[model samples]
Target: MSVSATHAAGPPAGGPPPSGRRNYARSYWLFAAPAAVVVAAVMVFPWLFTLYMSVHDWKVSGATPFVGLANYAKMLSDDRFLWAIIRTLIFTAGAVIAPVILGVWAAVTFAGNFLGRGIARTVFVLPMMATPVAISLVWTMMFHPQLGVLNYLLSLVGLPPFGWVYDTTTVIPTLVMVETWQWTPLVMLIVLGGIASLPQDPYEAAVLDGATPWQRFWHITLPLAWPFVVVAAAIRMIDALKTFDTIYVITLGGPGTASETLNILLYQTAFAYYDLGYGSAMVVVFFVIILVITLLMLGYRQKGIVT
Candidate 1:
């Protein structure tokens, strides 16, 4: 038969020849459709609603009036919101930096065949397994200037007892310290996985060249481990940016808004203040900040550096 005649006619005896691509495409929708539907239901719908709320003036009990960006404009002149953004940046930086540094150190330490390495690994990651609420409560008690064990330790060393989460001057730093302690183990676990997967050939070669321990880490290890470190850092940044339970439980965002990050402020605005429209705007802005951060981190990650 000619090409046009054969094409117009149906398949031969049984059926048309099977196609791998067509079969795979069919299977893809079969699996992905449910997940896509779920994402739209949970993530997309909420975001769309939040966007809707953001452009109107709606309190908990009031006639919802469409205000056309007035709520967003208010954010420009809102000092508390501006301060929340600044404090959020501070909290994110402090929370990410301490965990990453300490985690990398812990991972490197555990990578060695030292005594108690296995036990140390287990002990180290235990904090990550505990509930954040429980962790916050424990830290809150420990931060008490006179009654806490931490202050008592200072007295033994002839140092003055310090107010941790209670004092305005130290509240943010203290919360960061608590967060760093609780979350560093997570970073350590991630970095340890990366370290465990690293090739030994480079280290062996470095040793053959009479390289010192520090040199091996600085040259061979660090370059190979940079990607893993970035992954850990990104995860920590997102977690820190959305932190609320710890600050809420410990200080409730102050000794006068000293520890009020965006998350806490958003919570207080939406529920406590009952300004749903303005709160919705804050939510959108908060989300945009996180999205921008995620994009910047991912974009920088795409730019291949070191190794």
Candidate 2:
């Protein structure tokens, strides 16, 4: 029969009529409406509010007045804010790099079949699971200038006890150490899982070809593990960039604001200085930084995967 004659005699012959697409779309929206509402209420509303606040001169107790881009202009010239950006970048880099390096090494070592490996892994992961505030307080005591255990250990080693958080030069590094100690286990877990999931055939084949352990690791294991490493590093980088609680609990951005990161500066500006508009502007800048970094990391990951 001709196509038009068949269509006239019966339903259309395609897999599903166009009506099915309408039904599918309706069903999808039915399922998606609740999630969309929740996201709009929780995430979208707050973001829109913050963006609105960023463009106005809103004091804590006063009426908000539209101020164009004045807040952003002021931020550009604020020396302390500039310093905070530099400090934040330094801390984020240090926190991400050191933890990943140390964690990957630890994961590689623990990947071997050894006695008490489970216990060791649990112990190492304990810090990562601990509450950040609790860890910060404990580390604060340990980082105390004169009487901390860290200083005592220095004394034991016949070295002068260096002030950690108290010293301007050491504050950022001290925070990095605290962050690294707590987060290294997270990286280790990702690396370990990646390593464990890796196919053993490649390693066995390399061994059969008389490849040394180092050669095998450098050539095969590292490449296979790169995806997990990239993912873990990205996560850690994002968290490190936004770190606030531990630093707040430890330094309160004191010692002359030496450890004041963007978050801390935002807090101080909004709460301490009662400059809500300016604080919101800082937050917007921070959000931009985070977005840029995330995009770069994701782009790099995509490129790596493609290659």
Candidate 3:
């Protein structure tokens, strides 16, 4: 009886089965806990607080009260806010366009084997490496009406000396120039990376077809590098939209508020006027605008990938 029925119940084959998915899930949560907590504390909490504050009337000198879209209504009707939006769009466009065209050209030039290419790249990127405040200060000195180097150079060239930031008409354009100087290196680096990574097959084929260098670039290089161009443009656009430090240091959104972008207006509302509720509303609007732009960029990237 013992022999027949006492065949020892062996353990299940393959040692023990693998741990269940639930166990791995628990392990993942354990690993992610610190990051999740930090994100909740730093980002999610502040965003939620801002949203709550936006729906109320909160002043720096007084208690907050529920205002239920009043701040939004006020912002919508404020002519200055509308102007800020327009200026933001114009500034973004200028900042994105000039830097992209110039940077791509520079990148293409550098991609060629040339003497002193390293030195040239370093010089081009110096503006980007410098602190924005320092750069702005230098620009301010150069833009000085009487003793500035820029006007001095203009005088030498038989052109009239101009007040760059002080003139209402030229303030925004001057800021755009500063921004392009500081940020163009970024676009150049991106484009250079893309160009360097390109397969040589297409270029070789074009050469075999008797295509000139310019024709090869126009037909093969540009299309292949188009994705990187779009990406660089989007990054520049977003940075330009949020530009504050250089603008603040240079013009203070002045020359009669001609250069006040959305960020400047939001700063004025929150810090200058101490209207937290209104400021929060402005921030929310700006956030929505940025989100829409980012989504559009992502859509373009997806299209690039698919095609």
Better of 1 and 2 by TM-score: 2
Model 1, total clashes: 0
**Each prediction's TM-score against the native?**
0.90, 0.93, 0.92
Candidates in order: C-alpha RMSD to true structure: 3.8, 2.8, 3.8
Cand. 2 TM to true fold:
0.93
Off by over 4 Å in 1: 1-33, 305-307
**CA lDDT of each candidate?**
0.90, 0.93, 0.91
- For candidate 1, the TM-score is 0.90
For candidate 2, write residues 221-272 as lDDT tens digits: 8899999999999999999998999999999997889999999999999999
For candidate 3, lDDT tens digit of each residue in 106-131? 88898889899999998988888999
Clashing pairs in 1: none
Give the lDDT ranking, best first.
Answer: 2, 3, 1
Colliding pairs, model 2: none
Write candidate 1's Cα lDDT for 149-224 as tens digits: 9999999999998978888889998889988989999998888888889999999998999999999998987778
What value does the lDDT take at residue 274 in candidate 1? 93
